[model samples]
Target: MDSSSAIHGYVAEFEKAEQLVAATRRTRLAGYRVFDAYSPFPVHGLDEAMGHPRTILPWLVFLGGLAGGVGGYLLQYYPHVIDYPLNVGGRPLNSWPSFIPVTFEMTILGAALVAVFGMIILNGLPQHYHPIFNLERFERASQDRFFLCIETKDPKFNKTETREFLLELGASEVSECEE
Candidate 1:
């Protein structure tokens, strides 16, 4: 056809946070999955409307902490118990009490590090460019407006039908994004 091959998706603008949230809920019910919403500030209950599953970052952080704690304990145990076995005050070689501080510190460190890295990896951060940025109206996203975007990646997406669907949702304006 035309240059439609460059089309990435469609973005629908809403005036109110309520509209965005309701539109998102309806869109999900209409079987659209590959979509995202933007808002100037956190909107309560938006996550439920989006139907996003719980994240695994918490579990990852927990595992990181467990590993770090074990590593830290072994770090001291290996050196003090088997490797050198120094008898400073004739305290037990295991010295589990002293290991607690290092283990605790390592646990916190690992959890913090994993939390940051896991969030970055999960959210697909760094050096990013998205077709959504191509829309001039998107500049308002971080300021006042709210938006909903249906990406071409969704199997249910159709250019004509999706556009009409957004219009039916009472979108104030709709703009197409190009890849």
Candidate 2:
């Protein structure tokens, strides 16, 4: 029954997105880094309020495409030029034009695959459990409620202080999350 001993973190339930956003902003300004908010729908400007930086998934996908393109080109070039050395129609061994289609196809395939898998990796998916799931009311997050969590990993986190801060930000209810 001791609030100070909760290892998980603190969670604040908000009835509205505006309250959640404002609470996120205040938590960020108060110097907490490990925090996140969840809502039934995307909240405009919530990312800014939470101080989230842009994700690197786009760059990862681009690099994946580049690798696929080069790999595809090489797959065609190596066998045709060095392995088999086809002399059809007196065309040169290093026929750049013939390689274009496969290269383009591979590029598109790689980008699409990376877009799906990279997003999964970057977003830390396949997660089946989190401390926040301990809250029975948290199920409402997918229904209509907004929830903000300040993780114990945050440097400024103190179970009591964080709870009070959330309440001060007009949270409808503040509860401790258990790990």
Candidate 3:
């Protein structure tokens, strides 16, 4: 199959961050769903402009931490109270206090691991290439300029119309990206 068949859409470059932010807001207002913007640095209020919503990663990490805490406590409880049943110094086999440190450690570990892995999975990491990488101008997206890309998968995306819209929104230049 032709690699270009995986083409996502057109990318528009903006010299100023404000222009890019405004364009993102306009694109979002116009009901474009599958679009993303890139800037050399984080742009204030850009997420709101792009219609990005809060993520559930926090909840995922919380649940992971809870699971880890429960698992860690059980790991200690199972061997001591059920399997081995060894008691020293007349201490109770199900000593909850002894489990606290390990449980807390496991909770933190689980939260950290979930956060790192969840971010990776959610962001689609390990991607070696993208259609936008085909455009030479996009290289500047990390160094100097800002860019807004409207994916072809978007409901309102039309090559000509999207290009025209980006131009109307004050894009310095627009280019088609190929996969």
Best by lDDT: 1
Could you tell me which residue pairs clash in candidate 1?
none
Where's the lowest-lDDT run of ten residues in candidate 2? Answer: 1-10
Local accuracy of candidate 3 as per-residue lDDT tens digits, 1-179: 24435777889999998998889999999989998898999999898897667999999999889988899889899999999998799998899998999999999988889999999999999788777878888889899999999988887887678889989998889888875
* Clash pairs detected, candidate 3: none
Task: Say which prediction, candidate 1 or candidate 2, comes out ahead on TM-score.
Answer: 1
Model 1: residues with Cα > 4 Å off, grouped in runs: 1-3
lDDT by residue (tens digit), candidate 2, 1-179 = 36545667788999998988888898889898998898999999898998767999899899999998999999999999999897999989999998999999999988889999998978789888877899888999999999999888787888678888889989889887787
- What value of lDDT does candidate 3 attain over all alpha carbons? 0.88
lDDT of 3 at 111: 85
Give me the overall lDDT of model 1: 0.92
- Highest TM-score model number: 1
The candidate, 1 or 2, that scores higher on lDDT is 1
Ranking by TM-score: 1, 3, 2
- The TM-scores of all predictions, comma-separated, are 0.91, 0.87, 0.87
